[model samples]
Target: MSDQEIPAREPSWQSRRLLSDRLDWNLLRTFLVIGEEKSISRAAARLFLTQSAVSQSLKRLEEQLECALILRRGPRFDLSPAGEEVLRLAEEIYGNVSRLAATAKNPQDDVVGKVRILTISQVQSDLYDDFLIQLHRDHPRVELEIEVMRSADIQSSLNQKTATIGLGLCRFPQTKLERRRLLRQRYAFFCGKRHRLFGQRRLPLEALQGENFVSFTSDQLGGNLSPLTMFRDQQGFTGKIVASSSSFEEIRRLIIAGYGVGCLPEHLVDIDLHNGLIWRLPPAEGVVDVDVFLMWNREQRMNHAETVFLDSFRRLLEAAGEE
Candidate 1:
């Protein structure tokens, strides 16, 4: 048989051997981060490693896989077809590893590991202090990563498994997530001490008909309608809005500066009300009520640290209610 006519051996065996080779899990983790962030610098920042180290790790990973996984496109990195397939498999690998790590911990050991929480900004201010203090006291080994996000984003993060828990105003239907009512946040009209109606006990709703009001913007309020609009439509308020802000603190400051009367959550202004810096006005007919919830992905398993933090949060709420 001529040498050229001999059957050529397929590369299947070599490819199978490469597939069976054990890769470093840490390197895979770095690759996953780079894949998700699409920037070596960003991934390095997230992983708390130097940019050069991440670059080297990526090089090593490609060498091990024996294929070019990523292609540099101007300022960003795009995954090659092989990279896409690897990323999909890497996600499953990491997901199973995470679940295994959660359950494989010694049952007798103290609660440990990181719990990522996503909450609304206002809700964080109201509860994080107490929650963090209690968490540290009870489970010193547990680390927390709290991100302030909009109410609309909180549930999405929970469903994506990016956040282990969420605390926010429950605006979505409870179809895919588990929700426990945490508290009823009350919103009512407020005025600074210098306001005309500050000293009055029972000012009528009609009295504010032409007054200017301060409130949060629609986006900040996490709804289609602004708080000012809700009050105007539901409580017979006819005030003109003089100012709007994305910051709750800014709105409070504006109200205190006598910019205009504003609606604020009771918890936010409780101290100001006590200090005589702000006064809570009578609701036109009733105060605006929002039900805040503790939410999580229904399908995810809660690790020990997460479970402990959740239980402590519930207790704190109960204690606050008693007071």
Candidate 2:
């Protein structure tokens, strides 16, 4: 119970570079490569090292951090929560380092930084494509890193300042973020080739009542796809709700597989319509349209590259409006 019996405490932040002095930075680089390749052998191949060497480096990192970075069992390979965080930080570090190296190689007054854009899956935007092409042509020094994610996640990234910009469905207003409509995607019901209602033309509203339906996981009242929910209600089709997913691709696949009638963005299914995989159902005018917006946290300080890209996108949008 004496003061000398107490264990020595670890040094705080006052011990400058104490922890950093002992950490091997190469292990972090090795771990980053491992995460990207998702295989120790592949990472080793890329690093021009042996598989055992790469594995040992990962083990060393885990030991130093006091947590496992990855879960490897049988044929499965995945990141642990701690691993995910480390990987994220590693990626940010690499991205910034890459930008710095590029700037050093080609010194210029040009915008030179990384723009991180988080967006929802499968966004069909001609304007966005044009903007990317133009940005590359105008500011080759600026790098763009895009990641696909859920709409809600996109907002979180924007609000948290992790993402420089975002493209997604706006479920509710976030006062901290500035938003502008990028595109409006229209939804229409479709039946699969094997469905009983396939190829049916101009069916009355009452015909859809009591019919089974597959839909987006967010297609509920006050949800991301609330417009679809409102339209389904208007038609008196209560939606038996056979299955659901957040992914539009899965919903389309299930509808094509004849699980139930489902809705998809009309622009996204032209190939399916042409290939006879699915036929458009009732409501010739189409049901509801969801607005996807280009959003960012204007209150946050943006790097030169991010600010340049945002202005470029706004200019493109304005020119489109003028046309």
Candidate 2, residues 21-114, lDDT tens digits: the string is 7777889889988886788888999899998898889887776665667776665578877789988887666545544533332466467877
Query: Residue 113, candidate 1: how far off, in angstroms?
Result: 1.7
Candidate 1: lDDT of 65? 73
| Best by the TM-score measure | 2
Deviation in angstroms for 277 in model 2? Answer: 0.9
Question: Where does model 2 exceed 4 Å of error?
Answer: 1-105
Clashing pairs in 2: none
TM-scores for candidates 1 onward, in order: 0.59, 0.70
Model 1 TM-score, all chains together:
0.59
